[model samples]
Target: MVFEAILYIAVLLISAKLLGELLYRINQPRIIGNVLAGIIVGPALFFLVQPIDAIELFISIGVFFLFFLIGLEEIDLPGLVRVMRGRIFAGSLAGFFIPFFAASFFGLSLDMNFIQAFAIGSVIGASSLGVAAKVLTDLGKLRSTIGLEIFTVTAIIEFIAIILTSVLIQINTSDAPNVSEFLWLFAKMGIFFAVAGLLAVFALPKVFRIIHSHLRAQQVYFGLVIGVILLVAYFAEISGIHGAIGALLLGIAVSRMNREEYLEISKNVNAVGYGIFIPMFFAGIGLHFTTKFVEIDLWIIAGFIGIIVGVKFIGSYIAVKIAKMRPATTVAYGVMSKGAVDLALMLSLLQVNMLDDSLFSLLVLGTLITMIISSVELQRKLKKIVQVKVGSVEIGMLPIFFRRTVSDKRAQDAMSIDFQKTKPNVSVKNFLNSDIDPKEETMVIDDDGRLIGIVSKKELNNVHKKSRDVALISDIMEKKFHTVIPQDYIFSVIQKMNSHHFEMIPVIEPGFSGKIVGIVSSKTLLNLLAETKPPNPSTKS
Candidate 1:
């Protein structure tokens, strides 16, 4: 079993890597590679590539790990709250409520019992954090304010979804309820929060200190963390809550532990999740699709999907607009990207046999369609919300055409390095570790190795298309970058950053540029202006 599982993962990984690299060239998220692969192997369309149970187990592990990373990478709590409290917050609510209520209503219309209708709504109401995050990542806007806002809202909504899922599952039972006693559910929540609190207040510092002090058996520490996840999950299951809730609690508990360590763990977890567990989860979903949509009345399934998505989109759009979010257009459109939550809820329902195969497939289909459309809309229109301005500005002024250039110096006097200042094949990993202050723009020289252009943080972030995979100095270094000659004067750069509001400006020689060599940054310029005494008039004028 283990061997088969290992082989299955190995194949998927290799395949994902190849396709991922290919898609990456076109600026697509790597997750797309994995998800598309899952769909291809899924029973819905392709029944030939049957993944075994062992493979399914791997996929489950992947899902847990993926969420673990999300918890690790979640937004600043305060920032998240602020964004959620505003228009984005309103949009999230509208998105959740509209779909939820409408789905419930539709289920009832389909002659499903009241309990079933409510369950259906709950499942449809959940949003897809994975899909949303991946879309932003692929667009290279995950770090932007708008992306941050989206990710934050989706996370909070998921938390609510978890609680609702609990309520849906546990409370739906007959008044007596058979599994664990009623109090167990409440107790588990209490225990989780208590443990999470204690871990934050005391355990976290102590554990990190021990790990740092010992510096040995780092792997053992990771092992312990995994154990913590499993244990919490086990106890939660025993106590009547789903294992995923335990996973969340456990993630929260470890949230503040060493960031680097957490990132490392996330990498491993993602491999497992993307390569195995989560894929099986999605594939398992695919396996159950036995032409249910075709068998059922087209109007019934289509109508249900249409109404739920429409309400969500409309409600979110209106809420955002009311709250003064200018960029987000059309509520239904904004809120339509609800994939992860819905999928998770549906999968959970399937696990318990609450939703049969055909219904499950329909939900999957609806989610995929909505997700793709949302991504397209956001990328095309809504993405510009956060980047309202590119350069600095004074309320009213001549916008500066910011440029970079080398100081006006003789060839011999030019600031030069002993080592060849040519582009280096430095590793991306090295960039993370090295003091290559991305904010400090530097010009790249040509073969004669003369100054070409400058590179800025903003420039680095803009390389979505794969002109170069190596981050090779030559490939990525902006040799054709803008600049200001040293003789250009202060007002020129100010106008540039002010009107254009550039982060850094390359200072160069007037018409003498070979390669950019100097920078006049906005911060530095502001400081210089503040510190420098105004030049005395030549004739004491």
Candidate 2:
């Protein structure tokens, strides 16, 4: 049994890697390849691999880590909470109910019971937080305004769907409508959050910081993090919420640590997640696909898909339009992406004799098709978004799509070639005595003119005069600094400067050889933005 499980995992991993790479080379979402690998290898086609308890367990673990990583890297929890009340909340309310009621109404038209119809509605109503997060992360826009809005809205929609589904399940199984069950579950969710808040505010920071300061073994730290994630996840399950939420909450809490600490931990976590667990999760969705499509009524499935897709798109479009968000179509397609949650719900209903095999197959097939379509459309839409100014102050907060415009100026156009330069071996005394601007950074370069470090006049002044003659420029220069390529957008340069608190950055030649060509200062970039003349997009400095 163990050997067979290992063999199946090996095959899936190898297949996923090959297809994932192929998709990446063509600039498509690699997750599409990951899912395809699953379909090709699983019972849907080859019948060589089937979902077993062992595989299911691994996939479950994968899911926990997948959401956890997303929460850690992609989301800014405090920021998300702050923006939840405005257009984001409004969009979520509309997005959740439009498809939900539409699906339920369709189910009722088919003469299904209220409970079953409502259950189906819950499945359709929910947006996949996983899908939205993955696509945004792939496009490097998860931190953008649109990305934040998507995360906030998708999370709210899914949270409400889970609660509604849980309540409906209780009511369906009982002889009477169980108000007490609903109250209990709601109370549990509230308590779970209250406890999680206390942990985030009071417990996790101290614990992780102590471990980071006192511990030496990387394995121990990784093990402890995984342990914390599982413990919280277990609590979440007992509290009548999905374990993924707990993992996400923990991830958000852990992300509050100092950036250096966060990055150190994130590096290891991402390696394990992207390397194994995340791909496994996507393939596991594929594994659920069974070649059961022939028995379902094609027209019925088509109608259902059309209704859900149309309603979802219109609903999201209206909400975003009212909110005055740009690229409303892209946001609509993003919310349209489906995931394996509905399939799981359908399978559960099928097992309980609430739904027939044909209906189950119909829903699953419809979901898979929507998943692929949304991913393709979202990627295509993202590539075509033009960068236009929002406002002077708010421009920096714009989505990455703002940088994709052909008219945007590149780093080479803004950079100055006349800035001060110094050799790494030059004495600090000699460097300071030379004709250097105190306000500007002196770039330290090697013999090959490659940027190695930077020495600021302010930094040298802080050192005692007695040590200035003894110290070399290399000793005082900051070795770790950011650089921009000649072709990078000026907005990108501003972002890096804002992030790192740098006044100036070196412009280096692209590729392996980082030859220092010029420099861009915050003052110069600001002056350019203040110019009256429209920038010539074709010009390079």
Candidate 3:
């Protein structure tokens, strides 16, 4: 059994990675490949693999980590609340209600019971936080105002969906559904939120601080995070909510910590998640595909997909339009990108026998198709406004430019040949006394002449003032600063600089041993932009 399990996992990982890479090469979402790999390996093809118990457990863990990471990446509760006002509520309501009711009506017309119809409607109503987040990140809009609004709306919708799912599950299992039972379920949800909120606001920060202070090993920290995540998930389940909700809450709590600490923890978590668990989760979704179910009505399935896609888009568009929000098109795309939670809800309904194999298969197929279409459409629309290319590497979507200039060229072309460089061992006092500008950034090099770190004048001044003993440049330098290579497009560098609020960026040679070549400043880029003229789009290099 152990060896078979290992072999199965090996096949899953290899196929998923290969297909994911292929999809990415073709500019399609890699998730499509992951899902396709599962379908091919499972019932859709040879049926070589079964959804074993052990594999299901791994998939559940993968989903937990997936939602956890998304929460950490996007949610800042205080900030979200501050920014989410009337427009967010308006858009969320429209996005949730239109498709939900429309799908419910369709389900009833198909002769499903009220409970089953409501379940189907709820599945269609919920947005996939993970899918929308991936699209926003790909377009480099994850931190923008519109991105936040979308995230805020999705988060709210997800919370409501979880509550609704829980209630539906209760109704399905009971022989007689009573008002008291409904009230009690809602009460448990309220208690869950209250307790989770209190713990997040008070206990979590102290626990993290202690963990950081006492544990230096990355593995140890990773284990602690996983432990907490699981514990929270347990609490959520006991509180009559889904485990994924617990994971998301814990993630949001952790995101509110100190930036550096959060980044360190999030980076390690991401490595673990994307490296193994998350891929398995998506593949597991594919494994659920089976044609052994009851006859699938192609027309009904078509109606399902059309309603989900069309209603979501129109609902979001009309809502945002009424709210007087700009960029209605972007918001519409975001609302249209649905997958993760919808799949989860459908699975839940299937487990309870609320949905038969045919309906379950229809929901899964329709959801996947909608996700792919929405992602492709969003990418196609964004490409027209801004396109960023660095050599053969594309850096998401950037703002459109009307003209081309020297500054619009590669970073290697416009970088200053002369820039300040110093050995890592040089004393801070001596470096401050040198000819380097106190207001600018200075690069630190090692004995072998490789770029090691960077130091700003403010950092040096702080070290000089705070420390009684002398310190080397290495002591005050920032070892984690962003670095650009000569081959990198200037637009890519500008995006980084603008995002980080950096006045200057160091340019290094490409390869493992990144040797400092030159530095580019905003001023230099501006001068180049002023000196150069626009080129014909068709004739320009």
Candidate 4:
């Protein structure tokens, strides 16, 4: 059995990696590739893999780490809280409920029972954070205001979905719903969250302090971090919530603490999480998927897919339009991308026999379709400028005259690699002592040459003379700054510089290495626009 499990893993990983790369080349989310990998190897195709106990365990671990990493890296708890009350909250509600009810009613129309209908609703209602994050990152909007709105809405929607799922699980597993049992379930859930909150507020910080002060070994720290996450996950399951929720909670908690330490630990977590577990979890989706769409009525399948896609798009469109966010269609497509949390829920239901083979296949198929459509549509809309509203400022449409000139160009064409840079460990005093002019900016880089932040001679001169000797570049550097990659369109770079009033933007290497490859100045981009400026009517050709 152990050898069989090993063989199954090897086959799945190899297939996932190969197919994932193939899909990536075509600009589709790797998740589609991962799922395809599973289908190819599982009973749907070659039958090289099966849902075994060991594989299931690994998938569960994958789900845990996936959410954990998301909370650790993608979410900003404070930011989420702040946005939860405004138009953002209203938009999130609309995005979540419209698909939920529409999917539920669609299931009821098929004569599915209440529980089954609710299951369908729950599955379709949830948005995939993983999918949306990937799409936003690809568009280079992950750090933008619109990106924040999408993530906040996605997080809220998923949280609601999880709550509904827990209720569904209890109802499905229990012997007829008793009031006392229902109350007990809610009580357990409330108690679990309260305890988790207490730990976050009072206990975890102290524990982290001790870990940092006494444990210098990265290996030891990594081990303890894993142990804590696993413990929380177990507690969550026992408390009738969900293991992934616990992992997410712990991740968010640790993220709220010291950032430098969090970054170090998050780096290691990503290595282990993505390296082994996350892919298996996604592949597990394919293990359950069967090419049995022909079994279901064609009309029913059509309605299922249509309602999931159409309702989500329309719902998000309405919400964003009402909220005054422009390019509502783009945000709509973003929320339409589904995977991760929803798939995790479907897998859980399937394991417990609450979700059947046909329904699981239908839901999974619909989800994969949405992911593909979402990626393509969002990319297209973002690539074309029909005006975008960021915060209070509205960026008008790209002029027809410059569309051909600027849209086709990339940041690397105009960036200067000769820009000044400084090591993060250098003292501000020493850096200021160099020949750099007071007004000149310097990019700060780490030992690996990854861009960390930006600093200026002027800012360093303002530092108290006594402390300037002790303060490092990392201490004084401005951490919040925009960046672009070499492949980023020049128009987008210009738009960002205009919107944020930035004089220069750092160009990082591709693949998120954050290594400074070059810098694009506002002056250079202005020149590009000037050269393309049409001759005035008064001037002779």
lDDT of all predictions: 0.57, 0.71, 0.72, 0.78
Of the two candidates 2 and 3, the one with more favorable lDDT, higher being better, is: 3
Q: What's the residue-level lDDT of 95 in candidate 4? A: 79
- Per-candidate clashes come to 41, 0, 0, 0
TM-score of each: 0.64, 0.66, 0.68, 0.72
Mark the regions of model 2 whose C-alpha exceeds 4 Å error after superposition: 74-77, 111-115, 129-152, 158-177, 339-361, 393-541
Cα error, candidate 3, residue 485 (Å): 46
Error of 3 at 506 (Å): 41
CA RMSD of each candidate after superposition: 16.5, 12.8, 13.2, 13.0
Q: Model 4: per-residue lDDT, tens digit, 1-541?
A: 8999999999998888788889989888888898899999999999999989888888999988987886787666787678777887788788788888998998899888888788778878888778778877887877665676667777777777867876787677777878898898889878887889789757987887788789878689788888888889998987777788788878878887777878887988888887788888889889889877769999989988897778877877776765655446777777666877788888878877877888789888888888888888877776764443322333323365367557667898878877777888888788878776544554545557888887666677789999988998888788887888989998788767666544678898888677888888755564454355433569764
Clashing pairs in 2: none
Q: Which residue ranges in model 4 land beyond 4 Å of their true spot?
A: 386-541
A best-first ranking of the candidates according to their TM-score comes to: 4, 3, 2, 1
The number of the candidate with the highest TM-score is: 4
In model 3, the runs with Cα more than 4 Å from the true position are 79-85, 144-149, 292-294, 386-541
Q: What is the overall TM-score of model 1 with all chains considered together?
A: 0.64
- Write candidate 3's Cα lDDT for 411-501 as tens digits: 8776897776788888877777778855455454555778887776667777744452478888877777677888787767766666543
Q: In model 1, which regions exceed 4 Å deviation?
A: 1-36, 49-52, 75-88, 172-184, 215-217, 330-335, 382-386, 390-541
Native RMSD of candidate 4 (Å): 13.0
Model 3 scores what on Cα lDDT?
0.72
